[model samples]
Target: MDRLEAMAMLVSSVEEGSLSAAARKLNIPVATLTRNVNDLEALVGTRLLIRTTRKLALTDVGAEYVATAKRILEEVDELERRAAGEFTTPRGELVVASPVQVARLRVLPVVNQFLALYPEIRIRLVQSDRIIDLVDVHADVAIRVGRLRDSSLVATRVGALRVVTVASPTLLDKYGWPETPEDLRELPCVVFDSPSLSPWRYRSQDTGQIYTIADVPRLLVSSPDAAVDAAIDGIGVTFILEHDVHEAVIAGKLKYILQDFEIEPIPVHVVYLSRAAMPAKLRRFIDYAVPKLRELLAEFGRIPSA
Candidate 1:
């Protein structure tokens, strides 16, 4: 028996969930595939799989062996791809996760352009606000905002971002506008439930100071989008990421206040699990995404070369 080929067959069988499925993928007969697995178990002097009519289960030893086999196969596949001059050709499923707004405004366009350039690469763009379990979701990469809680994942700095206080023109016309952060207390405020908890932040031009404004909100909502809607409807002032309110501000739907009191830029990142070697598809996407994101955020200004 060819042990390497048999290992590949076993791995494929486990992944495909049935011997017949593996057989179909490998284009080999079911009997031939079963024989190869049996021969492999015999050669290894142990039963690797427990076969049932409905399902195939890996034994404890089989489970451990399968992990080792997968690593070996990946390395072998990389070697083969490199030898064939196909290692750098990006072609595979690439799953990425990001906050809903970021994915829609920033990452989706890049994803579209990337797919156009690499037709063979399939992408799953997971738009979410809560932190996603990369392993559970099988996410290959993630675009993260603010500080990352998980230190285990490898993170690359994208750029810094800031929050802005904005209100709709209709709202501004109804309620008197605040010239400074302290003046916000007189007007109704819209609170957004986010990781930031809607803490109003500002930087002082005269004293060169930055501080968080502690004002109770008249209206509160679970999402930034909702808060913006309320603000646009002449409800209250809301604090949100500058990017989130960019369109509304540009289209004259919303207007910003206390621009002089804007907060210092917060870091943003692209994080992924630590890998023995990054897949070509992932590496290429990172290379393509980082600079583009930075460029888009550059209007927010760079972090002064620290």
Candidate 2:
């Protein structure tokens, strides 16, 4: 039997909780995976897994073996990478997660350029508005906007984005622009349904005072794209990151109001799980990404109306 292959299959089966799922991930037949695992058990002279019709459970011995196997595999991988000069060279798959709008408008373009420069490195991007559990999902890095909760993760500030109130030109023409935050109470407000929308917090940089607009509608949506579409259709005034609507504003499709009131600039960060030592892939990515992100933010800052 291929002991290393069997060990890999065993680990995958344990993590996936089923032979079928392991097969799918490993790109092997279910029967082949089962046979390899059985061979591994026989070679070790012990039953590693307790199998039932409905479920698979690991024996106490299996749990111990799995931990050792994982460590061995990781070490072997590290050795191979070093042998290949990857310890000094950044090459391999880098999985990243970020919100949809940020991915589309900012990250994708930069990633495209990065890929062009480093053809050996592969990038997998997962875009969603919901927060993803990095460890559970096996994401190498994440780009997050706004305030972050306390965690063991390491975060580097990339830039900041302002939340802008925007509406279609026609809608603004009809409803008229509000001079003060209180005037927004009468106008149709497009509310983003995310947790960030709660209390509608704003602060004045000049006065150092905080204000929040309350009693807003609960027209919650999952994505900024949907919210922008709603605004473009004249549904209501919606709040979004200025980068998201900069093009629309320039095109005269969207207009901003309440510019004098200081909405706090939400900090953007590139976050990764803390490790004893940063791997080459992570370090190289940060080195490459930081400067590009700074340039992008500077470009956004120079936008005429942003």
Candidate 3:
């Protein structure tokens, strides 16, 4: 048995939580994965995994071995990357993770320019609304919005975004304008349910106090774009990032009503794993992307009327 390959499979199985899941991730058959893992256990003269129908658990020894395996594998990967001159040259695959709408409007343009400048480098952009662990997904960098939790990851602040409440003129005409956040009780609202930003909270500029709107949403949607669409169709008022509705607001399709009560601007950042020796490709991309993104987000963060 190839010990290195088996070790990798074992680690993958532990990380992925199942032999079948690891098999799918590695693009290998489940039987092959199982046999290799079994072989690894035999070679070690001990059982590493406690298997069940629902999940896989590691033995105490297995847990310790897996930890050692991870370190060894990481060292191997680093050595290979060094041998490939990734440390010296800006030539390698760079994985960047970003939100869906931001990827479409903000990040893609910068990526296009970066690719043109560095032909030896290839980029894989993973766009999703869900927040993913960078190390778990093997992403080189991630564009994150809002306040960041305390962690070991390095972050560079790019810009800020206002979360504004907006409604179409037709809807406001029917319901009348809300003079305060409390007035939303009788008005309809389109809520974009998301983990990143909350649309229901508002901050007062004068008092610096946060308040929650108790309005029951007429339309509750998952996607910000869909919520914006619902608001445009006069379904109800919706809260969204200012940039997402800039065009519609300018076109008179949507209007910002409660600017004074808008929540504090959400912070944006470019984040990556903290490392002692960073690869040239990642370093180059951060240098090239940060400034451009800062400029773009600044523009996006601007409220058209306010």
Which candidate achieves the best lDDT against the true structure? 3
lDDT of 2 by residue, 180-207 (tens): 7777787776677665555576666468
lDDT of 1: 0.82
Question: For each candidate, what TM-score against the reference?
Answer: 0.66, 0.77, 0.89
Please, what are the lDDT tens digits per residue for candidate 3 over residues 158-275? 9887788899999888999898888888888888887766548888777889977765688888888999999999999888888788889999999998877877788989999998
Please tell me which model should have the higher lDDT, number 1 or number 3. Answer: 3
Please identify which of the two predictions, 2 or 3, would achieve the higher lDDT against the true structure.
3
Model 2 steric clash pairs: 190-237
Candidate no. 1 TM-score: 0.66
Score candidate 2 by TM-score against the native.
0.77
Point out the worst 10-residue segment of candidate 2 by lDDT: 297-306
Candidate 1, run of 10 with poorest lDDT: 297-306
